[model samples]
Target: MSMSGDPVLERVRAIEDDFADAMSRMYTVGNELATLRARLETEASPAQWTPVAEPAAPPTPAAATAAPQPSPVPTAPAGLVTPPPPAHAPAYAPAAVPPPARPLPPAEPWWQRDGVVAKILAVVGATITLIGVAFLLALAIQMGFFGPVARVTSGALLAMGLVGAAALVRRREAGTVGALGLAATGIATAYLDVLAVTRIYDWVPLAGGMVIAGLIALGGVLLARAWDSQLLAVVAVLGVALMAPFVGLDHARLTGAFLLVLTIATWPAQVGRRWWALELARVVPTGLFLAALALAQERTAVPVVLALGLAVLVVGTTVAGTRSERLPLQLGALVPVGVMPVWSAGVAAPDRWVGTALLVVATCLLLLAAGLVVHREGTAPQHRVPEIALAAAGVTSLTAAPRAVDGGSLAIVAIVGVALVWAVAALVLRQRSVLLVAWGLGVIALLGSLALLPYVVLRSQAGDVGPRHLVTAVLLVALLVVTARASDRIIPATAPVLSRALLALAVVSTGGAVVVSGVLLGQLLDDPRGGFTAGQAGATVVWMAAAALLLLRGLRGSTIAVPAGLTLAAASVVKLLLFDLAFLGGLARVVSFIVAGLLLLGMGAGYAQALERSRREGTDRTPPGPPPGPVDNPTAPTPIPPTV
Candidate 1:
């Protein structure tokens, strides 16, 4: 344990330290190799390999001669290796390889770099700054900071905002800051202008500042297109809104017209497989606006304007049809026909002659046009407007005809002939209700004339009965026939009700006619020579009986029952009155009262039964027969005969 013995501890400590250093050097070399391998794997290529350098030392005799020493032991090869014996070698010594320098990481792209964050922040700050400035400008304008100068200033601000927005949209390179700043400035200016214009005028401000705003918006839209920007659509929408107030003003016509033109121009934007609805929505409003304007004014220009509007409507409808390939537009094109009637009504003179003639002509033309439209469209059933109009025209024309000839005699025969033909035709071709009703009324009118003309002539000769008598008789008979026909047709299948209605009407008309005739007879009796003879009275009674029989048969569901019953009833009433005057003498009064009461009772009972039967049958008793056929229900469904 002296100085020589202490050397052993020192040597042991040194050996341990050397071993530790060698392990450290080996670990460091291994880490570098692993890193290189990873880099080579990531960027797999032959460029990573390099040739090994030759050693500086020459092999000694022992090394060269030693059986080709096993390849120099590699540190941490597949398995562990023990060190050579100290007796064969001087000592174990550690060797270290210099560490490989790491390559710098690839630089980040500009967008992902820190500089981008700064740029974004700068843009946001600029946008906020621009928005704040605009807000302050608007506040200043509102406060009248520049008085009239405010207007120019505001206009300039709007122009600048619009230009800036355009530039931002064009320079796609300008990040979010430029875009936001532009949008805020443009929108704010437009809003301020809109406010200023609205304040100046109560409703429509399209004339002043709003116009400028609209122009700016339009510019934005164009700029956006030029720059391939989406902002244009937004600006265009704002422009449309700005122009909306102008639609309410009289002078806004120009603005409205402009908008319409713009809409038409932009219609292509809506062109696509799926944009039909949007396209329609876009174009229809312009047409509607024009139509409203045309309707609101009263100047002479109104007609021309309306005509232009009609043209626009037609064109718009046509375009919409082409674009959407839908039938609604085609159907809607017929709406202008309704307008013509309104115009005709407005222009019609109060004088019956002129108005009647004009109406007849207009109606005829309308009927022809409607027919053409229906034919062109090939719409069936619902397209009966022409037939309906023709029927209306026929009836109206008949109504306008002079009731009495120049001789003051009623033109009963002529009127009856016309009415009969019309009624028959209407019955044969019953497509439209109006036509049917019109023709039916015409027939009733004719029948009424035939029944009453004789009485009128008789009264005229006697100078007793006035126009009032003729009018009352006509009214009563017409009402009877109309009500009877309407009830029958409307309740076709309800046989009992229809039959009863016919019978009831027959009884009423017959009985009423008889009563009226009896009164006339009594007045005649006051004059001895005026009294009817016995034969006449008998004939009258026979006529009355015949009429009653016809009515009874009608109640049995005969198709011809109503007309036949009405005719017989009329004849019978005439006969009854004649009989009373000729044979009843002083009993005429009693006979008339009794007959009238019986007739009333009969009619009331029949009507009640008919209504009850109709209720049981689950049908309306009011008459309305089949749409097309005879006035009565045809037993068979007759095919429509071809027209000549």
Candidate 2:
């Protein structure tokens, strides 16, 4: 209140007040401008006006005005002086006439409004209305209000009329109406035709129905292009519907082929505008074709179907790669390649081998391509999918080839070898954990094949050095070496599951070898005690026990002791079988029980030890140094050296 007494203080107060007032005014102006800008930008067609004509010079008063009046005397409040008005004040009177008002433009149609909520309501209303109409039509058809032919004819005509009306409507509304109408018509047509086909002319009625459906769909497509609507999407849905009837029919093969060709031919016509529809169109027809081919029990179409699928996949992947760069598309492209092995497994003997070889080559090529893609564009995750697919394809083909070809024992060995090499190469180059695990699995599979196949092929001719025992010994050693070398790479805690799987494979293979040996070779040998006799059953048990011990020590995680223990327990079974045939039954049962008990105890102890060691190590390494020293004196130092 007394700031005027100090000049510096008074000046500073004045400056501060002025600054505050200026900032307040600035903020107000900024807020007003921002609000106006937002309102203007949101308008669909923001308004701007041009001058129609320059303002007419203010009308000159006719000749002279009435006599000029004298100015009033100025008044001021008690403490203020009144300022004089400017000298350039106008001397004339006010104008008599007013300016004309501008006329407003016409209101927009309701459907074309910029309000999102209103538009959404309209779309929902239209969809509901269409559904109601479809339901009514279906009810009318079922009620037989008109003769069967009359109902069909009237429904078709009504659909056509609705489509025509939709085309003439506004473009925005046309899409919704056209799509709904086309879809309804398609469903109705398919239902009626399918009923007629099954009940009346048996199978031949399908051909005529398909032709009609095809024509109607084509009409929809043409109308869509002409009217610039999304009717093609509806047309695709129609095509799929028409194909469904034939899907269940016995002539699925023929029908599928026809639809597939038709869809392919129509694809180019629908390239840019309706890509999702085009993709759906291609997928449905191709899927039907494959299904039909499979159901027909014909091997010849396998190659043709696979080749066609590959073509579609390549084109689809290329489009996706260029347009979107999504990983799913790249993965989708590899699906055909993945399925090729399954298809090849069904072909004739000679063709199957050729097909398997083709698949392997194709898989390798795809892997190379995926590598290139990854190298060129490091950001794309799509490239990894193809590599994964390639590995999968290799595994599938090798497994399928032997059964498909009906080849000799050595052929299975060759297939497993190929799989192992392929998997190892993938692991070495990629250093991917999934690939490494797959490689290990492939090795296990190879061992299984080698152990079982030769004895199966040799039948009664298996001699003293039959390959079964040799393969088993080699596989056991190999598994140990591989597991040992890869231990550091594999997280010890998670190795149990993988080790269990391998152990399971080993059990099945070894069990299968024993069965094959007994069935095939045991009958031929006169002495029945010559080579790899049941006497070695105990040795086999010891070998398995050793393997289990190694696994328990090396793998410090979950123990797949079940399979391991089972392997050892199986020796008792071998002993019992030999003794039963040799007429020493009671002794055999006693030895079997003893051996089984020992195996169980040994496995349990080994598993418990591993689990205890894991727990101890985990506890010892935790933070917050070992509890506390025994001494209660805070200042007293207790000295002890850390030991590893």
Candidate 3:
């Protein structure tokens, strides 16, 4: 270790000494720099500045304590000084230039500079650790030594810890630790309260213990607010404490109460409007409800939680969608929508019908409201309300309608009628989705109506035409006509040719429906099993003849009349061949054939006569007046050309 023995080693030691000395001076200069920074902070203003240098000579007693003039350079680089003037310099000196500004210090990360990450880890770790410690405490109390005093001791600890945390928050010294401490206290309180509630043979009333747990959370909220964003984490933990009941309690009402508390705790923070609160609100309630639903022994919990959660989700989603928070709202709403359909499917019989109707109605109303609110609050595209409403209704109907169909005719008719009514209303209101649905259902309805006639005939033949059946048919027909007329406005622009063809079809279908029903009504009064008989076929033939001749007469009113006449004549031929040939015999069959044939012949003659009369009337109309009569009196001599 002796330096004298090796010369090179001595030189190395000398260099080390120099480096050490240089570092020591750097430390000294840094301290001086910190002092200067402190002084500058107190002394600086627009009109004042601290002096960077002192005069060489000491001030006289009279001049002591007076302010010094500011130097041209407020601060100089370390180890440099103002240079003395040269002997040959001019007497008048120009103004001195200022020094370069100091470089700003690099900013420290929050975790490194302010202990943010450490504080979060400390508080959350402490809270989780406390729960384990509380179990130990509970275990110690369970042993014979201190079982009676366990509640008193744990309650005292919770109160003391909360008091200390509140004091820290109040002093503004706790940062995240205060909120975490508060949350840990809440977690401990929850453990004790739940234990008491479950082990009810103990002395403490369950309700009183729950009140204490609530107070713990309430105190946490107030303290957390003082800790800035720490309050959000605190609120979330409080939500977890509230969710504890969902795990251990079998009471359905308590689950609801727990969820409600969780909902309030997860509400958007009023202070600074903590943005994460929105996401928490969406998630925490769902988690609570799901946990409650999962743990419940009672079937009633499903419906109750579903209804409550749906209410919250609906308001939240609408608010969220209105605010352009679409993805979260969509994700939040999807769960309930999926679950509801499955729930509706699982419901049995009469209640199932009620549930399905509610689902459909709810879907429609939600869609309509959402579309309107979005359209009103935002710039939704045209037809948004109806399109979304109809689509949603269709989805709901598909799930609900098949079950309804399984319920029999009344169910089928009721569901179909509802869809029809909504479709018609949608069409009348200029909703394109409804218009499309209306037309589709119209086709179905038309086919359904045709199929129904035979059933109606069979029933009436068996004496089944009561007043109720008659009334139902009348209502059904009225609704169909209303639906058709409502869609009539779009005729001109939407394939006028096809639209006219549809109108013709509608006309033919309606007339045929009336014909069948009216003829069947008379038969019901006359005989129990009267179906397509000779007299009925003959009556139908005469009805067709009247329709054909009437169309021929009204050809001037509509181009469709000619086709209508031909259609009626063809119907007459079909009755003669099918009904009269198959069913009727003897005099009845002969009369039917005679009546049908005569009707067809008369229809053809009438059409021909109408066409001839129209052609003759066209020929008698005025002509063009003989081409101006050859330029008039060539006699006037023609004034010849005037002289220029």
Candidate 4:
């Protein structure tokens, strides 16, 4: 803000700074190119010039014939071949030079040449034959024929392989063969390494075996570096990984050691290694992480706390890597960091793992929201991921809560809490689309909690239609109505149509509940007949009176009251025609008619009085003008005011 605290101008200044820097960079590049071009011109090599030789006259026929029958000089190697005659003597000496030794047959590269298939077959055949021979030698050693010399034989083979590799490299033609020899030597040495580790395992401890394996891996790295071959390095490390478990440690130790080895190997790739290693190493950390997590799960005392600490470390490390420009490592670190907490929670509380996982996810999503709002790069993407995650997490937590928690009421409360959180976040975040959804889900949750509390959670007191039931019903109904009634406040002003829709919903919801409950209560208290009766007709009158009351409220400026009242009147009419006439006795029928008639009369009188009042107040009054018949007279009058 440059001490002025004006963020908009600060943003503009940053953009301008970037633009200026870009232009300056471009200008600098242009100057460098121009300077390089000038220098190149100054230092360019001189063009060679040769005196143009006059076209030599074609040799005369007699001289051509006379040219000592260029006897096919017996073909000789280049050094022995006759030299061409000097240009000055060429006319006479043309026949003295053997035609330039037939252009050496264009040397054919073996790969494209006809023999390539044969070479491949030979390499394959030799590899198979060697395998067979090695098998037989091993069998011989097993039979005790060469038991004393087995190690010596293997050592000799490795030494011979090294010598051959060296010879191939020195000749600079090793290409594929040297790579094979180096790999084969590593393989041969690997067995000896295993045997040596086996000896160490017998005497020292597990660490000794690990050291032996590490040494073998170290050899691979050294050889790969020396020979400049990634394949060998990969082979070397993979061999150690495959062999480590066979050293006879317990399953736990084996898994741990293996993960440790892989973790160490992952670093080279993470810190900017080349193609093959990077590709191979990319999978290493992922494998180790999963395996370690699995192992943790199996352990009775999984180090969940340690895992959390490491999760923090992972995040911090990634941040540091980004600051230091280790982008690949930074990207790699997210996987383990993300998975660790989830895995730890699962391991730490397997029975309620899902709930724990959901809680963790919800927490992370909120953190994302906070980060989105607070990060210096203020909402660049305006992403909705956190919002979406929040919703999903809420649902997951609710779904998991029932099974994990013992108290249904508490679970209900949590669901309600989550729903409210979503609704509030949507509003606070100014995500209008989320507003309606949040409200809807919140309504559902509130309804569920209210509906379930009496039946499922408080089933012992279910039969009594007491305050608990009434309160719960009221709360649920109020929530539904209020969501619709206050939608204008919840929904943005731009969505007037949606706001109106919510209002309509409120009217329907509240009005329907009022009519149904009023009817039910009337029947319950008076008739108790379980079907239509005189009370039903009474219920009809009650609805009509309720409608009249709403009309009065509407006249007092409550817009929703008008439709609600009208709807009540309609419902009452339907009930009188459909149910009351069908079931009510003669007396009930007579009373129903009288009550309905009186309600209608009162409604009419109320409407007429309201309209008359409006007229008296001049709001419904029109200005007096000469009746329509006096059009010509109106034309002769004064011009009307524009406001009119």
Candidate lDDT scores, in order, read 0.48, 0.49, 0.51, 0.51
Instruction: Give the least accurate 10-residue stretch of model 3, judged by summed lDDT.
Output: 64-73
Write the residue-wise lDDT of candidate 3 on 559-590 in tens digits: 66666666666666775677557755676677
Off by over 4 Å in 1: 1-140, 145-301, 304-426, 432-546, 551-644
Model 1 TM-score (2 dp): 0.36
Which numbered prediction scores highest in TM-score against the true structure? 3
Which of the predicted structures, 1 or 4, would earn the higher TM-score when compared with the native? 4
- TM-score to native of every candidate shown: 0.36, 0.46, 0.47, 0.44
Superposed on all Cα atoms, the candidates' RMSDs to the truth, in angstroms, are 28.6, 18.4, 24.3, 24.9
**423-478, model 2: which lDDT tens digit per residue?**
44443454453355456556655555554554433323344434535444344434
lDDT of candidate model 3 versus the reference: 0.51
Candidate 2: worst-modelled 10 consecutive residues by lDDT:
60-69
Deviation in angstroms for 359 in model 2? 7.1
Q: Candidate 4, 455: how far from true, in Å?
A: 4.1
Q: Which structure among the candidates has the greatest lDDT? A: 3
- Full candidate order by TM-score, most accurate first: 3, 2, 4, 1
* Model 1 residue 30 CA deviation in Å: 76
**Superposition error at 509 for model 1 (Å):** 5.9
Candidate 1 Cα deviation (angstroms), residue 233? 12
Candidate 4 displacement at residue 466 in angstroms: 12
